[model samples]
Target: ADRPLLHGVSLRAAAGQTIAIVGQTGSGKSSLAQLVNRSYDASAGRVLVDGVDVRDWSLDALRSQIGKIEQDIFLFSRTIAENIAFGKPQAPRAEIEQAARDAQAHDFICEQKDGYDTVVGERGVTLSGGQRQRIALARAFLSNPRILILDDATSAIDSATEDDIQRALRRVQRGRTTILITHRLAQIRWADTIVVLDKGRVVAAGGHAELLRSSVHYRRIFSRFDAALPPAEPALAAA
Candidate 1:
């Protein structure tokens, strides 16, 4: 059967709000993301940005405003600075450095023999997985997209490094809309709204406590964090 990948699915995020999406491996999370940036068009329905459907926008005009940090980070055989500045090719040195610092990549970048000028191997093979992700994050920070998509962006970083990056994520996420897909309870805890998907549909959506109390689907997906969440608000729990 050629059923739609996503049906009756809708998500809305106020400008500068963070929306976290969580589901099992094939719950259409990434499909929903691809639609937003038009990596592939939806077979039906629409993805809107600023009340305008994405298909109505030009690729360059649309994509320049979106930043993405995925689990698989790709880099060319170029200087570290060039890779970070890939999107904004003419980014000033100071801005690039600041972005790197925010991504917690600056110290390691400076430690290289050529510092920012170090030429990484093809696809950043010279860098460790965590380093690659931080560099990808630095690129996103430098681009300063109005809509940021972080799909398992911190998976490669260690717990301690992740803590630093999490603080940075909290700080930099201000003033932009963020679409997050991650399993880390730490990052998911702070989202303005959490949308829970199941079998390609949105099964539930709400704050951590609300979902913990109300959504069986969400609870199963995030049961490990149940003890850590604050109890649901009395009124919300009663709903």
Candidate 2:
């Protein structure tokens, strides 16, 4: 049975803001993302983007207007340049390189023996997981859509690299709505609003601190993250 992935979940993301969806596995985070892009029509509610029903928008135009990065990155059998060009077929090579640099992919890309001309192996297996994800991000950046959705796109990346990707995403998200879907609380600390899901329903919605102090589920998850952080170093003694 196709269960309802979201139930009465009402939230908002204003222009130039970031909205993050955090929850445990099978808790509907990815479903909400797909719902927003109308990949799967809602069972009983509406999914709106920029004041318009997603279902009402023309399919090709709708997809082009919203950039999405999934956990599993997919690349074509063509050259890396062609894959990056897939987002905006007419995008100039300079623009593609700029986006790759922004994604922190240019250095590694150029280091490849074939450089931009390297053919991405089937499903991009020729590249590392992080490389493929960065390429995916570069493609999204090149699209320059009004909205961006990243569904656990950083799961395969290490913490330091994740931080770098977050920085890059911040620059790209300016003046655009960004939806980050993940189960990691640390990933949503910068979100304008964090929506917590449980049993396919919204159990909390607020900024990180507000939820940490007021929402039980949020507190529990945040406590786990807090515990994982390295202990602060003692202040250096005056010499």
Candidate 3:
């Protein structure tokens, strides 16, 4: 009763589809996603992953089954290859390369003097933000999990690069359930379902068009995006 971050929030992420959660800061969107992997223990109800309560699953197994991409991507002080291979240490070199390629990282990676062997500076300081995100994505791709949680994962990349990243993501998302948490309506306008949260409760949930036409919460959020968008790229407004 005290914990209402996800109050009566009943939503489903069908297999092979993407679900996005939109909300203002502190609306508990992150809290809800964290519940999926038990990042933070829920104070109230259970979080089910693959039909089993997340608390009931082995921590390692549950984590490995879900790929979480944070807003701020963190990389270690190691060669690019090693960083991407961090998740699946035993993964073959070919698989590593394929993952980078799938993440649309191979092209830029090849430009590095040492290619995949290039040593990342402290905290990956040697790379650009977009490059870092791609590497992080490659790391996730290496795991090949059943579920993907992207927490504003593409916020730093340019629109063009974001498109490439989304394309790569589209390819990998087949048959995998995805939970995309973002404030940008443009990023999630195409999600299979959109859940809107306000003040730590589910205010509205439905397909983008459905909410756009019916939910006041959805309309307010869309207006925020409309104000954020550039006139030339009103395409993001289609949400």
Candidate 4:
């Protein structure tokens, strides 16, 4: 029998808003993101995009309008330009360069043996994890989808590299709906809304301050990472 991953989870985000999803290891966070792109059809509830049920839209048309960056990046054995251009095969060279620049990958890419023409090995095995992620980000940036979903996309990157990517993401997120699934408190703090999930259900929904003050589930999760967080909000003391 197929076990349900999420149960009665309903959430909403306005256009151009950023929503961060957080939970424990088995909390179905990634599964929730997958549903946005119809990666796995939900057995019960429906997923809507721009007021239309996603299932009703043509699969290619639906996916082409959404950009997804995951923790595990896949890069074909091709030149950096080719990979970035995969988003829009006929994209101009200048556009691909600009996307790399936006993704903070231009500098390193330029230093490569043949710059954009440098061919990578299978799955980007020749590049560092952070480098591969930046390439993936560049591809997404080139796509410029209406909705963006980031599922622990920066987990493999170091703190410094992650900071750079976050800066790039802030710029790309403008005017587009963004859904972030992450464990990083810093990333979570930037979201316009934060959703706390537990056992496939949304246990709490609000901004960082509000969740800290009202949700015990949130507080407990935060407590585990307290040292990494900034000063505890005074409101949390009374929660």
Candidate 5:
């Protein structure tokens, strides 16, 4: 069955700004992200990019400038270098290596017996979650997207590998507009603006600090996140 998940949802991110969308599991966070690159078109209103309606842009043209990373990274049974260069097959080895380095994947890739020449199992079965994410990041870097979308991209990995992915993300995010959907407080706090959704509608939109002070929904979500962390993990805020 199909249903509309969002109602009159309106928001904007300035060029090079990072906007995070946060909400409960069914609050339409991912659905809203799906509209960005036009995975599904709005039934009514328009989605604009660079002042042009996304519907007006060719899919290939529109998608080429947008990169996305999700919780489950997909990779083919190809050489490591080939996987990283998937978006830009003509990319030279040096550029591929540079992208991997920027993604914090170079050293680890080198550790493989055949290094960049190693062929990963289907869907990257041979790689760790963090490794696959880093490879995805390397692919994104090579593609050089003008806009990047990350949907809980770090939520599944261990904290240690998460640190590496986060570092690579910071490097890759420069000079691009980023739409982030994450539960991690670390990722949420870095956004230029955080939009809180409740039951498919935006309940609040503001800086993290501002929302914490004024939006009950935001505070509730934050507290829930805080409570879910391990005992040793620092609270997102005081009780």
Candidate 6:
């Protein structure tokens, strides 16, 4: 049974702005991201990039212009340098190192047995979840795409690691559009605009404070996140 994943969901993002999509599980957040990079073509309506239809662009050209990192990161069984240079194979070593630094991955990578030359096991099995994510981020940063999509990319990471990654993401997001599909309150708070999805539809859209005031659905979701936060920190109330 093929049901519509998104229904009449209309939204827009300005260049260099961050847009966060927040929702409960099965809310179609990932589906929306997939459509942006053309991983899944929309069954109806259209996706536009730079005011142009995504379908009109060549697949390679379209994908090359977008850098996407999902929760399930996939890294090859190769040296750290090789993996980072996957998108730009001819990139100089200096450029690769710069990208690693930008991803907050350089320090750990340098500590590895052979530094950047260390060969990872199949699917990066030798690396921890957080390390693999940083490597994936470094790969995306090396690509230097105009648009970045992060689909819960930091969910598996601990708070400290996620903070480092978020800082790196802030630097990489400059002069580019960023879409964050996540339920983490911290990540959602970073967006210039937050879109709330429920059952494949946009239930609300606005800034964090504005939605907190007007949308009960959003407040309810935030309440759950609030309850999970440390008692010393007044989560959404302070936001």
- What lDDT would each prediction earn against the true structure? 0.87, 0.82, 0.83, 0.89, 0.90, 0.88
**Which has the greatest lDDT?**
5
Candidate no. 3 TM-score: 0.90
The residue-by-residue lDDT of candidate 5 on 44-142, one tens digit each, is 888889989999999999999999999999899999999999999999999999999999999999999899999999999999988999999999999
Please give, for residues 1-239, the per-residue lDDT of candidate 4 as tens digits: 97899999999889999999998889999999999899989999899998999999999999999999888888999999999888799999999999999999999999999999999999999888889889988988899999999999888887668789888878888889999998778888889999999999999999998887777778777778667644445553434
Cα lDDT of model 4 overall?
A: 0.89
lDDT of 1 by residue, 64-129 (tens): 999988888999999999999999999999999999998889999999999999999999899988
Q: Which stretches of candidate 1 lie over 4 Å from their true place?
A: 224-239
Model 2 bad stretches (over 4 Å): 229-239
Which candidate would rank higher by lDDT, 1 or 3?
A: 1
| All models, RMSD in angstroms | 3.0, 6.3, 4.8, 2.3, 4.1, 4.0
- lDDT by residue (tens digit), candidate 6, 182-221: 7778778878999999999999999987887777778777
lDDT of 3 at 85: 92
Residues 48-79, candidate 3: write the lDDT tens digits.
87688888899999998898888788889889
Which candidate would rank higher by TM-score, 1 or 2?
Answer: 1
- Per-structure clash totals for the candidates: 0, 0, 0, 0, 0, 0
Query: Per-candidate TM vs. native?
Result: 0.92, 0.90, 0.90, 0.94, 0.93, 0.92
Arrange candidates, best lDDT first: 5, 4, 6, 1, 3, 2
* Clashing pairs for predicted structure model 6, backbone only: none
Indicate the TM-score of model 2.
0.90
The worst-scoring run of ten residues by lDDT in candidate 2 lies at 227-236
User: Which has the greatest TM-score?
Assistant: 4
Residue 105, model 5, lDDT: 96
